[model samples]
Target: MPTARIYQRPKNAMQSGKARTDRWQLEYEPAEPQRPDPLTGWAGSGDTRGQIRLGFPTMEAAVAYAEREGVAYTVVPAPTKTLKLQSYADNFK
Candidate 1:
């Protein structure tokens, strides 16, 4: 049986904007460990399912799709966001 994980997309660390972070993503767990190719010396795996990522607008939709497809999935809760509220003037202090 193929195992999958459903989770909310996290904000990219490269940018401050949170675009597309509201969506949930479904990804399959790797069936086998990756190995370095003998000729190219590049890490590769025979399981192509690891490259597949399905996105849904909501967590419920992602879960529904997993159930409908008979895919065993686990929901990974999104991390909580915390903001340190500070004013520009505080820097002077």
Candidate 2:
């Protein structure tokens, strides 16, 4: 059985911007363990089913895609972080 993970893209930690935040990503959790490549010595997985990432503008779109593909998925909610308001004048104080 394949399981899909749906999650919202987080705003950049250093800088908060709308860029990339509106998109949601649907990814497949690898069902098989990763193995090292014999020649290159790089870790790789034999199962490629869940390696692709599908991005959607809305959560509904992502969910719909998963449903249409007959993929069992679990939604991972984005963490909430509150920003404290500040003013440039406060720096002079």
Best lDDT goes to which candidate? 1
- List clashing residue pairs in candidate 1: none
Summarize candidate 1's per-residue lDDT along 26-81 as a digit string, tens digits: 99999999999999999999999999999999999999999999999999999999
Model 1 Cα shift for residue 47 (angstroms): 0.4
After superposing candidate 2 on the true structure, give the runs of residues whose Cα lies further than 4 Å from its correct spot. Answer: 14-16
Model 2, 7-77: lDDT tens digits are 99887878856698878999999989889999999999879975699899888999998899899999999
TM-score against truth, every candidate? 0.96, 0.83
lDDT of 2: 0.88
lDDT of 1: 0.97
Q: All models: lDDT?
A: 0.97, 0.88
Please state the error at residue 4 of candidate 1 in Å: 0.5
